[model samples]
Target: MARNTIRKDENTTRRSKKELILRLSVYLKPYKKESAIVIGLMLFVMLCSVLNPYLLEIAIDDKVANHDVMGLLEIGGVLLVLNLVAWAVSIIRWKKIYSINNNILLNIRRELYTHIQDLSFDFFDSRPVGKILARVVGDVNALKNLFNQSIQLLIPQLLNLALLSIAMLMLNVKLALVCIALLPILAIAMFCIEIFSRRRWEIYRKKRSNLNAFTHEEFSGVKVVQSFAKEKDTNDEFKHFVKNLKKSWNSAVRLNDMFWPLVELSAGIATVIVFSVGYKLVISGEIAIGTLIAFSMYAGMFWRPIMNLSSFYNTLVTNLSAADRIFDILDVKPDIKDAEDAEKMDKINGKVEFKNVGFAYEEGADVLRDVNFNVEPGERVALVGATGAGKSTIVSLLSRFYDVTSGEILVDGKDIRKVKLESFRNQMGIMLQDTFLFSTTIMENIRYGRLDATDEEVIAAAKAVDAHEFIIKLEKGYDTEVNERGSRLSLGQRQLVSFARALLANPRILILDEATSNIDTQTERLVQRGIEKLLQGRTSFVIAHRLSTIRDCDKIMVVEGGRIIESGNHDELITKRKAYYGLYSAQYEFLNEGA
Candidate 1:
């Protein structure tokens, strides 16, 4: 497979941030009651905050200036009460916001996972597991701050700014005008910075995704890296990815950092102007000292929200790329889906046919061309070929992993594509060269073939593939817990368990592609005996590298570059002395030489 690092579809029609934000608002609808309560609490908090500075003006200009100590004490007591109430409400708001964030993110990740499961193998073929993990995990996590800080503050911040401006203006309009003088200029500057910062943040996200992909792929294949003594090469590549991420991080952070300082400096200069001018007004008695002080403080309050809004906007810009990446995966339509009116397949007898079927992973690069074959009900057929030949591709087409680029496949004379995927796939069992086992007990692993199967049924499947003995020998027997991918098990043991899994499914049509290649000669013979009995009544396809494993197969087809060059029973192919004959001879001699 090619190294497919690009996760986003370049051809996808880009959506404006407005559209994305509006779509995100839909999630809020479900939590409207909680959201409304949070908003109400924030409003009360804002009211309490803004009223204090006004009360300060009242106490100073009315009570303190008139020598009324009792009135000043009452005002101070009211201020204390308001602060206590605000603090208590603020705690509740924080708790509610956290709950909302978790629930919304849960919903998004659930939808993403469900959508991905329905997508075709073609979607996975071009993207590494690491890149997919990055979007699902890291990218989703990046939206947390957006929800907590940005969304929670959005309405509150605007309202806060409005209240502060009104209070400042009511105190003294001259100072208010001077304090807001630079806002228009700040807005223009923000617009310009955002345009450039948005692009840099996107680059930063892509670089992080690339690093994730490279790291995951190397770790997955770490065994190969060490076996081939490529650790130095791999470490060098790792360093390159790290350095690229570092550079991208610096570029994106430098631009984003400019916002906070810029907002602060502008507000600082405005405050200086307000106070300097207001000092003259107080002395001239155009405004009292208390009013001038209150107005200047309110001016400060007004810009604090502006600073917060700037911070919120910056958060949006930073995570917008993450949202785009997430939506990109969701936007991909499954390549292989049942027709709209498709229905469940009829009970299968496992009579299968490939009628001039041709397939390509890429356009005009056919992997299987004009492939034609049929397996009669209850027949056992083996496919043999060198690496890169169309042997596995043919079976993959039969299983509907990828639709044929040309021609069609029929199961029981019904088009597979016209049948619902779940209904069709349920009747077929497929075991690939690499068997993947989840981190669970061995019993649970076998029972995955049929979730409702009894312990007896699972054990029977294991006994059928001769996996029962080794399974019992484990410290935990059938309940033995396996690590991820069953790494604790030997290759041959894992293969045997995989065979048992396929057998437990009791599929009408079974395909085993290089399933027994990892087993030893003795174990293969034992497995062969059990498989022979099981193969008596089901149409099955087997692909193997060892020629001896398939000698008993009813027929053998020798596949070459996207075509079947020879087909016959084992003895008949040997007599013909063609492609199958040569392949068998070479393998036979190699086995003897090894002995």
Candidate 2:
């Protein structure tokens, strides 16, 4: 089983790498015009490199040895012109390729970012925010060198090698054959190096991602760590991740550094061989002095490109793993999305229905199984249950955040799956348990509910929810700035601000998922009055821990073990003396004792 699992993992990695390469090619397609110009410039540069040596041969044998000072000067001028042209071409080629590479990187980052946003909540639920950020910010940036080196180093080096090889063959065939013989040995060495280096770099990338995930999670919960006095424990844990990250980085860099030395050593040996063999040829009168000299230069030129190409290949191997990680996210299909040919829903009447709807995050452990319920239009319903009893899951399904694993949910007699998501969700508003506020003015945050809402309309919504009083008391009133997640405001204030935002959305169906849990009992009374006015004409699903809060609800459903066991108005349920009776009795006694 373990071996099979290993084989499966290897196959997956291979497939993903192939897919990533194909995707990268698609991104490169748009820059073909620029690429063509770069390649043309490089070809010119390659010609100059070979021509300079040939010009040297001419200056030495024909011009100087023949004692023609005028001819030597003329050839020297031509040589200078050729080198200048090559230098200018190099500059143009680099500028063109850099622009192309930056654009490609930008496209990759944007597409990955957009794809992440389209992904469903379950995608986020399974992965930490840090790991996702690492892919977006760190992993995407890591590929910059891979793309830059591929064009700037790999292509030019290969072109130079080819031109140098041809020049060597034309000048002296025997030495060219010697250069050829040594190349295979170098190629074999590089191939071996690549195989070992790739896996080590992959391990290094994974370790870095792990460290990032831990850092983000720890710092985000720093208050909890301090409250529990677990600072020493967290510090020790952080050190452990740091130690592992350093070890993996060292392992990867050690192997990657081997490519340069191996290539240099091979180049040195090849140069020595050319001198040894070429001397005998020149002494035997088989080749001219100019030809031997130029051929020797060609041999040296050939190896430098080979070394550069080898380095580029190593860079590619290292960053391909990062590219693979990025493609992994881009490949995930969103779990919740409107069906093809789905129609836009009309204004929602707020009649919600669940018919035998079943859902599970995993395959077997059902959070809600065979759950069925319906709410009338403009009714106020409260879902009361212990933690993890699937109360929130029901509301989430209603909001279409997660599709049911089986059966269906309907809004106004139409299956929600058959309606376009934006149209369906536009008419609904949800105030989550954990209130999140962007770093912006409180007025803008509330305006986020309805971007087209006028300032007066926003104020009206705030007044309806009794949030305006608190807003006006702040230094800047509704214009007061709030930090991310509303950490600047007290918990109850944050909830009130969130409440006002939801009110501003003016949703026909509103869900308050423990929206009042943060408010103190005194504040709760004031907020409760606002809640009463807020629920007037809208169909609302209120999930509350405090039973007193739901006593006035039109219908109350007691959920247990993923099913509704008892349901009725508060008075009717109290008369039954069943699950609802037991719950209310327990809560009433607890509250009295606390009082």
Candidate 3:
């Protein structure tokens, strides 16, 4: 995998902030009634806030100027009532917004999770788990913040600006026009800043994701790092990556920082101009002192909303960048999918056929080239080959993990691609050289093979694979917890548990890829006996490193350079003294010498 390509160019077809907000609103439409209540409460809060400035104007113009004691008391009482109403409205809006934001976050998280599950394995194969986690958790959270804060303020902020502008203009048109004129310049500045910040932010996000992937991969392979004494080298590499991340981070923040102080400076200039002009109007008897005072207060209040709009504009850019990162994952089309008219196969007879099959992970370098093979129902086929000889690739194709580049793979005489993935995979059991066990109880792990299987059925499967005895010795028996990746169990034990899991699935086709390679000789013999019982009357394919495991297989195939050069039963192959014979004899002598 090339690290350079991890951060691609920004998506050319970027969605505008308004378009994103509209799409998010549609998602919230299902809860329209609650949304309506939230909007209403927010409006009430804005109305109360606007009334505060008006109250100050009235106090200066009417009560104070006229020296009416009774009028002053009545105005004070009304002000108190307005404050109380504002507090109530604020609380109601807070609760409603909080509830709506949480619900929207929950729904988005759930949808993303479900969509991830539906994606093909190829997507997971290329992307790191940590990067995926960041998109699902971190990026989604950023979007939620944007949706909750930006959206809730959107209508109220616009309305406040409009109302304040009108109130200010009614007092003095010249001053209002001055403030309005500055807006276009501010708008152009904001647009330029947003464009620069978006690109910088995208770079920062990519670097962050790359750092996450590197950290996750390193930690997961910590034992290997320690065993090879590569700690210093790894630490230095990590520091280099972090340095790149910090540079991008600082660049993004610096660009955003420049916008706000400039806006504040412009606001200051606008204020000085308003005060100078308004003071002259009052001195010349052209305007009343009350009107001049009101105009000054409204002028201050008016710029506040504009300042907030500027801040919101920056925030909107940040949110959109985060949203773009999230949508990138959701937008990726899965490389593998069943045909549109695919149907479920309830009973698979286990007969597999590959006709003129060719495949490559990358084009032109064929992993399996023009290969053809057939295994009848209940036949045991052993594939023997050196590394990179396409043995594992063949099994991967048979299981439909990757579709053939050319030709077709048929299971029970029907193309595997024409069967629903769930049904197709359910009919086959695969055990790899390295087994994976979830952090769960023993019983639950086994039951994962057949989700609806009863406890009794689980124990029966474990017993069949000779895993029941060791499981019972654990403190919790069937309920014994297998910590992360079953680290508590020995290698042989984990392999046996995996065998039992496969048995529980009761698959018609079985694939064993060096399943017993990690066990001791004694455990190997025990597992071999269990495997014999498990493989009885089932169509099985065995990829073996130790030749003894496949000596009794009905057919032995020699795969070399992506083609089967020789194939026959054990006795016939040994007599032929071909590739399979040479491999078997060499391993046979090594084992005998050790004995």
Best by TM-score: 1
What is the overall TM-score of model 3 with all chains considered together?
A: 0.93
| True-vs-predicted CA distance for residue 229, candidate 1, Å | 3.4
Reference-based lDDT, residue 147, model 1? 82
lDDT of 1 at 235: 90
Task: List ranges where model 3 is wrong by over 4 Å.
Answer: 1-26, 593-595
Instruction: State every prediction's TM-score relative to the real structure.
Output: 0.94, 0.93, 0.93
User: Could you give candidate 3's per-residue lDDT for residues 250-286 as a string of tens digits?
Assistant: 9999999978887888888888888788778778888
Show model 2 residue runs off by greater than 4 Å: 1-12, 16-19, 475-479
Q: Report how far residue 28 has shifted in candidate 2, in Å.
A: 0.7
For model 3, name the residue pairs that clash.
none
TM-score of 1: 0.94
Best by lDDT: 1
Clashes of each: 0, 0, 0
Q: Which stretches of candidate 1 lie over 4 Å from their true place?
A: 1-15, 571-577, 593-595
lDDT of 2 by residue, 1-595 (tens): 0111100121115344456667777888888889878988988988888888899998898888889999999998998899998999899988998999999999999999999998998778766677778789999999898888767776678778878888888888889998888788888988888788778877777777777888898888988999999999999888988888899899999988988898888888888888899999989999888888888788878887887788778887788778778877887899888799899999988898999999888545988889888899999999999999999999999999989999999999999999999999999999988999999999999999999999999999889888889889999998899977788899998988888888888899999999888899888877877788778899999999988898989999999988888889999999999999999999999989999
Query: How accurate locally, in lDDT, is each candidate?
Result: 0.87, 0.86, 0.82
Give the Å error, residue 208, model 1. Answer: 1.6
